[model samples]
Target: MSSAQYARIKLGNQDKISFLSNLGTLLAAGIPLLDAVGSLLEDSKGGQKKVMETLRADLMQGKRIYASLSRFPRAFDKITVNLIRAAEEAGTLEVTLKDLRDHLQQEIEFNDKVRFALLYPLIILFVFIGVMLMMLVLVVPKLTTVFYQLGVTLPLSTRILIFASDLLIKKTFYVIGVGGALAFISYFIYSHKKSFVLNILFSLPLISQLVRQIDLARLSRSLYLLLSSGLPITVALELSAQVVMREQTAKMINRSREMVLSGKKLSEGFRTSKKSLPTIMTRLIEAGEKSGSLDKSFQEISNFLSYQVANSLKTITVLVEPVMLVGIGLAVGTMMMAIIGPIYGLVGQVKFR
Candidate 1:
């Protein structure tokens, strides 16, 4: 691959996990790092192949592994780089690699669960919209002509349906163009104004709570890994801050890091900042500090927060399913009433012949 292609080639989670697991196993078995990376070339393909080749080349040139990994920011984030660097410095590469693989696997599974939980509601909404649009364009106009031909007053619901059907059929291109433009604009704003969008999300009830728990879970998990790998507390906090998505949570972590550097206890910093942190986390950290097992405390906190996030996702899925079903039922009932109400009125006016 060319330099530009190499720069653009980002590996997926599974690829990184496989790379770490294999490399760690080889190193544990007393294989040299350079030879292990070279051996991985037998199975590597595409971007992963490029990555392994580059790493082997870097190692041959006497550059550190972490330095080579830092070149691929998209594939290896800052947190991964720092952890590996710490491992290399402290002679714990095998252990850190194993931890990294397990961490990545957990992250992937949790992300998949969250995505699957939300997918059902989105599918239902899109299906409902598609069915409604088909009825408006294909079915409503035909029934509207019959209602007007009866020479009797139509109900308000029928009139509204006719108006909508006429608009869709007559201004189809205009509607489509406007809709496409709006969708593009919405996507642009959502991408470029993430903090603004997050602010809106934070104002929501269920969504805000879910967002908080997910970010906390990520932060705690990252801190646990970084601290357990022999990283300094402030450095661990700083790296953990980058792993969370919420702007507020990241700022709070950064503030906590500053406080830790100023000689305050980590839990004291967390408790004092308290911008977006929960009391439970601070309390756990305090207890962990007193017992001289802060890393273990973060591990427990991560587990608890992850469980809460999973349960919250399940609860949301359950609640949204019934609400969306009732919404679809209401929409269908209105459409049925509009179409059938006029026919019932027309039948009553006819005399027996």
Candidate 2:
């Protein structure tokens, strides 16, 4: 992947989460920081081991964990590092790490579910493409030979198929080159054109809702974590924006931050933002503000959105699987008919003669 690709990737790493979870456990067991680091270092290997050793060295030099973590921004995002800094200062490192561990676990699980849900469709698509290519490049050529040998006037469909097969078999390198270039250009455009990508994403039907729910879930959970860590609301909102994946959602968050500074409540800003996030979110935020429990309210909203994300993904999987299968079947059936029908016609003419 290019640097732009890495820049656009979601925050958090599974290995970092495992490390945080284990570190928290060790800390809770009353182990000194140095010994814990050493033990972890002993068990580590490869690039992760190198990072751990650097961290251990930093600790040995009397630097803080968050300070060391800040050096590796790719692995530990600003939100995670700040949370650890706050926990370190407030003397709640164990609890903070555990909370972070839980957050990372949820992120990992969500990503895994999405990958699995999409995997089936992708596999089917690849298989369909493979079968189609084989028929076009291999099967169609043989039929084309037979039709030419018999001097039969091929149907329009067969002629089209023959033309396509000629392109596949004769212009093979040109096709591959064009495909490779398209893939690269697509990646570049998608990574750089944030607003374009967001607009396209939100224009889709089911996908639009799914994207919004997932973004809302992430933002709510981020706010809950940051606010619960004793950060000011403004700071929390700013940091929470960085944790979300969508560019438009991040822009809305920044807009809400500006609104908060101009004497508007966070709930009002959330309600009035361009996206118009769920009404229930604003209602609960209002209630939480009145009761001085915004953290809990945000957590509840996060939980609800998480469930919605899962349900929406399941619904998409259920609908798309059958549609894809039917589409493949129809495509293959059409191609077979196109290739075979002319041969049958030629055979009948021969028998009549």
Candidate 3:
């Protein structure tokens, strides 16, 4: 829970989206910029309040909103800064912020939907583990002592269960310490070796697809926003690359930007990088290039990728439920047989005696 709090402090997607939405509303209402920011600062709560206060101070010092936000890279990611910069340059900051807020809200809702879908399975898993641990540490040892007093010779499985239960009861602290150490080491490695972690993440099959779609959605959205605001294609591509979360995807986009700068067509660059793009996206880009509607095409691509990712997440959640149920059933069944099978055999032997 403390980790979750720290994560929220680091500018979670939901927090930024909420802030952007409120800011957009304030801006759209014709409020003065500094006054609106000051009001927001006063209303802000939790970890984000400090960020808002700092931003307001910077605004008072003659810095633009986007530039002020740039000072807090943890709070305002590159994509956010690029969108705000585009909006300011186009004299449509309010409109752009509203769009960005909408995009961020959609992403947050999509993530929530995924989490909601997985909630039941997660609950079941947690309950199963808790029950199993209690049975192992509390019930098993007592049953073993009873069997010993009754002069009953335990079966191999029962002996194994008793040994495991004893070990768990005796070494629980050691196990917990090791687990904590491993968790800390994992976090340290993940934070310091981002490229390595990202590469390994992208190598997974289903997760790789999901990540690619997410990257494409972000790239297309950022590119659309920049291009529609009249940024040059080269600059839009470069900024979009910075906005991409995946290192591999960013590298691909950078290469595509280079191709565009070298006189290659946008469609050609996309077509050549099909691994980083969907076939539908390639076709849409080609058509947009021919029709001079690249901005609209990018928007359509963003929407399509967003839909795909949402559906994929739903599919994954649906698939995980039955699989988790089966796993829990197997674990319980195995434990019950280990405990009950010998009891039935003992009853038969007592009847014979």
TM-score of each: 0.93, 0.91, 0.87
The candidate that wins on TM-score is 1
Worst 10 residues of 3 by lDDT: 1-10
Q: Give RMSD to native, each candidate.
A: 2.1, 3.3, 3.9
Model 1 segments beyond 4 Å from truth?
1-7, 149-152, 273-275, 351-353
Itemize residue pairs with steric clashes in candidate 2: none
For 1-353, candidate 2 gives per-residue lDDT tens digits of 34443334333376787689889999999999889888888887755676688779889999999987776767788899899999999999999999999988888887787788889999999988998888887788887898899888878887888998999899999999999999999899988996797688776888878878888998998899999998888999999888776677888899889999999888878887635587788889999999999999999999898888889999999999999989988988888788778878987998999
Q: Of 1 and 3, which scores higher on lDDT?
A: 1
TM-score of 3: 0.87
Tens-digit lDDT string for candidate 3 (140-198) = 98888877776776788778888878878999998789889999999999999988998
Question: Cα lDDT for residue 269, model 3?
Answer: 76
lDDT of 1 at 339: 86
Model 2: which ten-residue window has the lowest total lDDT? 3-12
Instruction: Give lDDT per model, in order.
Output: 0.89, 0.85, 0.81
* Backbone clashes in model 3, listed as residue pairs: none
Best by lDDT: 1
Q: Provide the clashing-pair count of each candidate structure.
A: 0, 0, 0
Error of 1 at 145 (Å): 3.6
Task: Kindly indicate the candidate among 2 and 3 with the higher lDDT.
Answer: 2
Ranking by lDDT: 1, 2, 3
Model 1 per-residue lDDT tens digits across residues 37-140: 99998899988998888899999999999998888888999989999999999998999999999999999998998999999999999999999999998998
- By TM-score, the better pick of 2 and 3 is 2
